[model samples]
Target: MTVMRFDNVSKVFYTADSETVAVDDLSFEVHKGEFVAIIGPSGCGKTTILSLVCGLMSPTEGKITLSGDKKVGYMLQRDQLFEWRTIQSNIRLGLEVQHVDSKVNRDYADDLLKRYGLWEFRNRYPRQLSGGMRQRVALIRTLATDPDLLLLDEPFSALDFQTRLDVCDDVYDIIKKENKTALLVTHDISEAISMADRIIVLTKRPAHVLTVHETHLGDIDTPLKRRESPSFAKQFEVLHRYLNGGNAV
Candidate 1:
């Protein structure tokens, strides 16, 4: 049930004078319906990995595989919604881009808006919605395409602390309810601990898998609830130590 696999994947950027290695021998697997988070220090090529998966960039050496013909939907740091487009039109952007803007896809998009409580705002512009709601719309737009795997590239980093929390819960609920597989790249240790089923830690530069931890907090339904769990602090400390190059067990 592995939706995606990275086998010794390496990515290098070559300029006129020098070549910078962004990823080195990276290997990871994301299974069906699982939320996996990649955490590492800043400038660790985390975004490069997502680009590789989405076919925006090819690996310099090694292979990247997706099960069957799984399509990947990327939710970026910003909502990236067109200011001129109404919510309804914005939701259909992906479908239109993919040339699949048929009745069925449009209906599915409307259904998502309704289910997520954004139906009332369908005629409104992105400026009319709050930051959190805008993020929701962006997610729904991504879902409109019905991608097999989702790539979340720091999707909530732009939000304030409280809004980030609320949006995290909403996004997690939607993803779980839709039974979608997600791979999130985040620098927030607590965010990773709260939302991910497994956390993949990477090295500083020329990123590679440093370690992996299975978050045993799946039973705690929401991100806020998971944050309140007694083990939250302990897990955060473990990840923190790893990022700081401390020996942690």
Candidate 2:
């Protein structure tokens, strides 16, 4: 099933003096229960694509469609957790905002916390947790709302190298375990290769699809395991060249 579709979508930013096209004739589909990553050169308007999907912005031309009544949960670069709120409160924030903070929904949120090993820190502030743990909280908070599709915009970019790797695995595991579809936007080739089932490579500016690569890393279940696969380096090189102007093979 197609969870989201972008059909010939284009987005333009207009200034008083000039107009800039961020995305041009861009098109893609994110299937249900699939993890799709978008990777491109710096300033390639990856985040703009996410904004369009979440209705923060609309495309200037063409159509953007979400199947049925699907709700989108966005996890940004930083955890963006409120320091004043306890971890439990942080998780409930979304439910409250959406006015779905019923007994059943709150129970589901608690279940996620317990299942993910975050139950112990329920009363702790965001600052009390490690960077990795905080990110887990962020993911749980996003999940608490029971969104059908997730938009991850460089979700792990703010962490340190080692923390990023560990958190990448954690986030991937959570998303898959919950059987949720996700669209991630990142500039890291290796990160995209490790986490995404299918990767959409975009052109420089006025971003459009350059190529889409299906990562066939067998039954690898974790990002770290995917990175250690023999095919990992090979796939990385292919995407690296695509972003650099070399033709896709």
Candidate 3:
């Protein structure tokens, strides 16, 4: 079943005497439990797509629909954890915000920390954790709200190369294990190819769907494993060409 659908959606930004079109008549569907990544040229309004899905901004035309209650969990470019709060406290922050902080939900959040090997660090502040660990905590907090879908906006961009790969594996594993649907906006071609079940490539300004690629890496157990597959390089090249405005081969 489809969890979300953007049907010919377009977004426009207006100033006193000017208007700019960001997304234009774009349409795509994210199915339940599928990981979809969106990649585009810089300034192509990639982040704007996430904003639309999360209801931070409304589209100028067409329709955007989300399945279930439309509950979305967003993970931004930074970990965004409060340095003053302990890891556990940060995880509960979302529940508290929604006025749903109850024993059951709190237990669920704790269980995630424990299951993900974060129990030992629960009492530690964000400052104490490494970059990858901090991102893990951020993912836990996002999951605590039990969102129907996750919108990840360059969640690993701040990390170094090695840390980014490790965190990519960690995040991908958690999302798959939890059976959650996710839409990621990223600029890294290899990252998108490895982590996404389907990748949607967008055009430059006035962004629209340029193409979509479905990945089929046999016997790949994790995102890291997918990267090891010989198909990885091929897929990366395909996405690279498309991002450069070249025709898809």
lDDT leader: 1
**Winner by TM-score:** 1
Q: If both were scored by TM-score, which would come out higher, candidate 1 or candidate 2?
A: 1
Candidate 1, 116-170: lDDT as tens digits: 9999999999999999999999999999999999999999999999999999999
Candidates' lDDT values, in order?
A: 0.96, 0.94, 0.93
lDDT of 2: 0.94
Model 1 per-residue lDDT at 54: 97
If scored against the real structure, what TM-score would every candidate get?
0.99, 0.98, 0.98
Q: Which stretches of candidate 3 lie over 4 Å from their true place?
A: none
Q: Once superposed on the true structure, which residue ranges of model 1 sit more than 4 Å away at CA? A: none
Compared to the true structure, candidate 1 yields what TM-score? 0.99
- Candidates 1 and 3 compared by TM-score, better number: 1
Clashes of each: 0, 0, 0
Error of 1 at 194 (Å): 0.7
